[model samples]
Target: MPYKPQSEPGKTAYQPDVQITRLGEKIGDPVVPADFPHHILRFRNDRWDQSIGLHSLNDEEWLSHFGKFEPLADNLYPPLALRYHGHQFRQYNPEIGDGRGFLFAQMRDHEKRLMDLGTKGSGTTPWSRTGDGRLTLKGAVREILATEMLEALGVNTSKTFSVVETGEELSRGDEPSPTRSAVMTRLNHGHIRIGTFQRIAYEKNEALMLQLVEYCLEQYYGGVQTDDPAAELFAKVAQEVAKLAGAYMTAGFVHGVLNTDNINITGESFDYGPWRFTPYWEPGFTAAYFDHEGLYCFARQPEALHWNLAQLASALRLIADSEPLVAALEGFPKAYGTAFTQHFCWRLGVESRGFDEDRDLVVAAEKGLAEKTIQIDRFFFDWGRAENLAGLDENYAAFSEFSTLIADRERSRQPVSSYWQQSGPCSMHIEEVESIWDAIADDDNWKILSKKINDIRAMGIALRIG
Candidate 1:
């Protein structure tokens, strides 16, 4: 069934009486601003969707609904049309920008937090070239699910604001034949990317490149005060990207594609293309169909990010020496390690140590992967259950009984040993694992297990049995 978007009940009504900016006009003639194409568009209004009803308010309606001429205060954030270059498939393509998107406006949240409200699939611009500049409906659906799930898992990410179906049919080679399109409104710190730096660098636009460095520092890294802005810029960018690398690894997420174009200058996860949570720990498992070499595989994401950040640093050579950039790059491993540790600690419901236990956890997980062939989602989902404890008896009495469920149900015929053997050694480090047998020694275990279940449920994860 086709999905519907809904508005929230109590959201402050927003009416978008957008003011066209001169900086934005030069690169993309204004559908609302300059440099924007004539065919550019805003989403159509609809009311049936329960999910994004309030947020999905049309641009004009948003202005009227909020009873404000501008949802974002003027002169606060100059909406400039960004120009950038990128490498596509290892080949440098020096032309790209928000060809189908743009920075509409920026605003301060209730907490004085600054954020940009940007649109995707808003339509063509000078950078759109001959492309239709339309986004498939599937893309919008994917973004919503991706952002929601990532948030639940406690990852820092851009929030989805609204998705408006354009009522336009478009054909793209990559999408299902006869695809429908939509425009997405999303919130983020800034729409800048590493490709933004690459573009100006390739053009030898030294002035603009310096302007971008200053802009990024002021907009995203307001804390770092350095005499050399260029050096500070690359230094800050490198650290943020590395931190994001650690966060991605901890969540077992594969961004699938980490091209320079996808590396946001704000270090917020954006451009959700071919992303997936790991179903299992296969190093080569990939989410993007076009990633034939697995360059951005589950295991390769961190290194790929380092490489991308290096490219960004290389471009800074025009303004800053390479040595300082290299020095900043050296800090990546420690930063990434620390972030991943914190995230992993949260997921495991434990206090974090200062470094990664990722490799050890991966090794331990693989034992079960090889032995039980348990589905990744299901294994984590069911491991906390009472039935799982019943399978812990050393004599294999309860374990044998539990096997009937798997054996008779047709999920597996292999004994629990297949998986247990591989993970047994690692289990020694986990406290209370051996107690599973004793816990299940009588009915007392059920009461204890019930309390544990409720605790995890309160953590917003429902570990349902398969």
Candidate 2:
């Protein structure tokens, strides 16, 4: 049966207030492809749709908006390919923007929080200077896995809204050549990047820079209040990004690309290009194959994010006073440390006693993992269980201090299940991902991939993560 909308179309709380694209030359406008064949709906996140009030979109409507890149009614039309410049691998690049993707639409979710539907492999844009604007099916699958796994791990991340297979062949140096093509949409809080500010700063347009800062504050930082709104916005973003950096550390995930362009103002992790989760706690782990210098390595992620936040501060300086922006940047290290400790405790399913105890627990946990050479997921899975941690070793003495705290905490709304008692926690390792793709690529089978997603979702529920 063809999927049908559970609610009325165009009856949504659709707010098409697009501020970035409204700035004419500040960003580039791009149109959707007219000839690409929209073949099949490979994936759709109806669970996420419920939160955004987009569950009413039927399959045909979904294909139209996601696969064919049709503009949402009363939303952003003639989707804009955002323009920005960034430092790639610590080297400044002047000519990089949305090459194969564009901002498709924006809306207010049920909570009235602003959300954007950004596309990948939608088609060629003005930014696609010397390359074909295309995305491989494998790449789309990887993104879906990355977002799902990260979300399950309680990391603030963009949700893979939809993935549609576009019937076309594409050649690539990475993965198999003449691979199938796909178009994907990610539902994120906002698309405003640090590079957005950097572009105006490069052009020396203080007026536009200030305007951009104001737009960001109105959209993302609506709750923030201060004498200097721009400086307050910078401080808020720095704190959010610092928390994000801490989440990455606790989750043992490397985003691979920490470029300024990839760092969004909302500090929610998006753009999963070459992301990977470490099998073990290894600081020097690098996800991208081309990252020969390990510039954005696992341990160095905090450093890279701090650097990106600094760039944002520099851009903000074109409008705001330098002292306040510098002051905002100075808070990153402390903010990251605090967030890391909290997130680490959350992963262990223990209530943190306090900052000092949490810090000591995190230190002990890391030392335990290193000494035992334990699998990251296994460690979390075992530690998350109260029963498993009831009898702790001397190595886990610090964690044992939280035993009473864990027992005293409120029980989860959901009942405990056998999923947590499994041999190992759900993980999206490279080998498993490639194996799932091999089934689809070689035999046209999606069973394994689908099952894996379901299993991952189950793990999220078992772990009490939203």
Global lDDT of each candidate:
0.56, 0.80
List model 2 lDDT by residue over 1-466, tens digit each.
1111112112344455555564666666666663576569999996777666678889998888888877777777778888898888878888888988888888777666788889899888878898889899999999999988888777888999999999999999877688999989999998888888888889899777767777788888885477787798999999889889988998899999999999999999999989899888888999999999999999999999999999988888877889988988998998888888877767766665656767776776776666545678877776676454555456555444445445555432323667766766898888998899899999999999889988987877766631
Clashes of each: 25, 0
lDDT by residue for model 1 (134-195), tens: 67655765675565555444556776665655566778887556765667767666677888
Stretches of candidate 2 exceeding 4 Å from the true structure = 1-22, 388-415
Please list the residue runs of candidate 1 whose C-alpha ends up more than 4 Å from where it truly belongs after superposition: 1-60, 63-81, 356-466
Pairs in steric clash, model 2: none
TM-score, one value per model: 0.69, 0.91
Sequence-dependent TM-score of model 1: 0.69
Q: What's the true lDDT of residue 169 in model 2?
A: 93
Residue-level lDDT for 413 in candidate 2:
30
- Number of the top-ranking candidate, with lDDT as the measure: 2
